[model samples]
Target: MSFSIGIVGLPNVGKSTLFKALTKIKVDIAAYPFTTIHPNVGVVRVPDERLDKIAQIFKPEKITPTIIEFIDLAGLVKGAHKGEGLGNQFLAQIRNCDAILEIIRSFENPDVENVTGKIDPKNDIETIKVELELKDLEIEERNLSSPTKLLQSKSEGKEEKENLLSKKPIIYLLNTDGKTQYQVPKIKHLIMNLKDELEILELSDLEKKELGVKSKLDQLILACYNILDLITFFTVVGQKETRAWTLKNGQTAPEAGGVVHSDFQEKFIRAEVISWQKLVETGNWKKARELGQLKTVGKDYIVRDGDIIEFKI
Candidate 1:
């Protein structure tokens, strides 16, 4: 799936630095405010060690990792809702994203001038939240303002109404504690209510470490994947390398095969599947097959995480 996360924050908040760190690619970072008028897009690799084990097991010729795209949109000013600072266009760039990674200015560096003239992480976070809430509210208002209600059939109208009422989920990212102190403010005055309403996750340091296996970059991407409810499966051909494949949770075998190649899906016969645990115990595919530990499944068999699947075509 072409899933993506939109990275948004005020100017000079280190969104570009985070993007560069995540994607390991260089992008234009301006020294002053409003430097990034156009957002930079990057695809970040999702780290998985299961790929190594599967490679050791089946030894596929190639390994494929999953990725999520991130776009660093221009900074939002105080009056973003009022069409200030690339306002509406920036919001529109984020509309198609699966979710948002809100970057709040949580760091205070004397070198990095605060356009607002002060450093307050809470205020920074609240500013972004209020902007997004207003953006969503505007969307909701537009949906309500539509006069062509009769154009849709009864069922479609009901579905549309349901959609207009439901809130889009967001994941809040407080970019590494940057010297700024955390201070709690009044719930109503802050963005706490909006965050709760949207079920937004305020990432904590403990959670980040626990989620990643090695690197913080790896952990952040893993967190994003789990947050999006994505699943990973394995494909091991009898080559030297093994690969990891990602599919939506509950995807069927043929559909999963389609992720590898449409031809694989078309020519599929049956899938010989073994769980990672079974492979670890059985030691090899031949042993697993001999012991009938390998499951011979049809298209309906749901692809699972860590499944070493050898598609029969």
Candidate 2:
């Protein structure tokens, strides 16, 4: 239930500064390139508004959100594919990541040294992409060069099956976009439905009203939500704060209970679930359950984003 991303770039390309900004922890940052010889690691909470709403209803002793593990590894030089310039060590660390965040320094500054000896975002991006592609291609080429030798052994088959996890994706975190580019897995049922042949209209009055809630780093919460592939469910009561809990898309009730604790999942029980769209349309969870919009689903049900679930453990 855990995933990770590797932050990569050339030397002195603000990887450490970006890492500090992300985790809010201090790390070594020097004017000189290669200041960080060892990788810096940080785990960031996946913020979810649903956890608060869920708390509002259940008043749980604790609330937990999913997390993303990030690794700020050493810079990739031109000859990294050939194990040059701390290449083998860095590549080894990153090869295990579920995804990659390539940070390109779009801004220009002569004071800081550029490992490639210049500053250009597009060129820098290409350099990193090419190196990764080269790394992949090298594997592919070797697989082809000695297919009989590598694959003929039975043990090699098991290794190849497990090695599928090593197929990491390269996500470009554009300079202007901040971190949104790599935040979400662009695959979900509801969003897919909404965005299918999507169109944009001018901002509405309601949207303008909602904008006030975002005070700093407006998209940060949304980014965390995406990273977790989470769905939000809310609970509200009179004289109580509306609470939200995070559940993964397509997660079952028992699986979600596991998010809270192993004890809950172990105890075993049914779930009181209501669709958020129904609540908004009907104006109450009681009415939602009455209208058959609320559902009692087993652990096998695939949780959707914006679902309102209350486990009946």
Candidate 3:
């Protein structure tokens, strides 16, 4: 259930700034290329309103939300696959991630250097995509050259087809200047001024609203969650803790239990399940059961988002 997202793009595209906003972990955000030679990693707790509401109802001592790790990798250039700039080092780091958040610079600043010479989001996107595709082609060719090694990988339960970097899910982040007119590429993208977001990051909610600053960091995080097709389930232990857990979509009850604990899957019997909304309306589990809102589900039951489950092991 734990996964990572690689924040990649051409240099000076605000990747590190976005990382700082998402994680509050400062790194070298120079206006030049290769500022982030080594990847900076930080774990971010996914924001969930459901978990907050559940905590308000249960009044638990501890509240735990699911998390996603973000890695700020060095920038890629036009020939990254051919050892240009940071080259394969950046691509290699990206391959290890579950998903990619590609930052496309659409902002123009005289102080900030543009690696691509001019601000063209479409061209920037193509540059990154082609590099990834070329790198994947290289990997595929290398695997074909060593048939024995390729066979070994397949025998070890690795899907050679899905191992390609281009095959991974990608979400484009258009780093805008808030007022500049830029060509928006025809792809899945979110627009935000990374510098502005960082400036307003420490301000209170009311202060942010007063300044007309709308932060899209949460939306970006949720987009990453949705891009991976993940769903969340909750567990509330009376007055002790309320926790949110992540699972892939279409997973079953036993699999959900496994997320809570490895042994819960094998020793699982049945689960006491109730929708989070129903639990909130009924005010308590005991009352929900009394009103016949709680249901018992077996291993075959597919877990739904916002489900509060009590696993029987």
Candidate 4:
């Protein structure tokens, strides 16, 4: 299973442009509002140095990295929660996402139209937040006989696990032009010239290096992982393959095994675990075992990031 993040914003905020840059797959991009009615889905592999190191050491025939799926939805306008501008349909597309990336326009282009007719990131953020909160409250009211007080109170809590759009962890992305200067707050934010960078992506590796351009794509993916509170683990299949997997922050070994396969979860007996760092330091698993760096853990073991696990059924 892959972690998913939904990209949201007001019209002409470069949401689809950023999506194209990230995925290298172009979707319809225009100056008009509501250009993207249906969500555009793209899968991106999670970059890990540990996976490269493991591949280098083992010379595995195949290596599979974990991935994140990005969903780009249509823009939101005022009264979105009340079914304005296809707001309800767009919001519905993002309901199952693991996190949200709210793109705010920090650049000015008279050619492109902003639905709000201004480039105030703060106001744009509040507009999206208020609409999502209203939508969540509406959903709760329709689905439950509980009082509004309980829903409101639960919504105020730090960790929102109830699939509420407003309550989900959010990372603000400032869609900027190359020369535009914008003040960013203390919250999570990323500044990018999506169209320009997307053109850079078309260049060859040698050309990119000649231009001294190091892409921030991997950094963006890692940021998404952080907001979702995800951890990566590894499993090697004999001498043929090595693969990376993701688990939630406090998930158990059995639950993690379920991510690999259903039968692995049901038949799990125990796991041989070791940190990828320790394994690298020891040169091999046999040496790590001899050095007592390898551990035998049961179903109750909480998997840590960078753990290399061998499940015994």
Candidate lDDT (C-alpha), each:
0.70, 0.62, 0.92, 0.85
Enumerate clash totals for all models, in the order shown. 3, 10, 0, 0
Worst lDDT run of 10 residues, candidate 2, spans 189-198
Q: Pick the winner on lDDT between candidates 2 and 3.
A: 3
Candidate 4 lDDT by residue in tens digits, 1-313: 7889999988889889888988878799998888988999999888999988877778889999999999988999888889999878988887888899889998888888877877787788888889998998887776466656566757777233467888788998887876665566566688776777787888899998898876777888899988999999999886799999999989888888889998989999999999898888777867788888889999999999999998888
**lDDT at residue 300 of model 3 (Cα atoms):** 99
Question: In terms of TM-score, how similar is model 4 to the real structure?
Answer: 0.91
TM-score of each: 0.79, 0.67, 0.98, 0.91
Model 1, TM vs. native = 0.79
Candidate 3 lDDT, 211-233, residue by residue in tens: 88788889999999999899999
Which candidate leads in TM-score?
A: 3
Candidate 2 lDDT by residue in tens digits, 35-100: 878988897765655555545444555555556777888988887888988887888787777667
Q: Candidate 1 lDDT, tens digit per residue, 1-313?
A: 6578777778887777677667756777655778788888889878888677666666566777777888877888777876888888887787766667766665566777678876666787678778877876776566567756434534365453333212444566655442346664433221222212111233455764576422345666776777667788877657755767778888889888888887988888899898888897778878888899999999789998778788888
Query: TM-score rank, highest first?
Result: 3, 4, 1, 2
Q: What C-alpha RMSD separates each model from the true structure? A: 7.4, 8.9, 1.0, 3.6
> In model 4, how large is the Cα lDDT of residue 79?
88
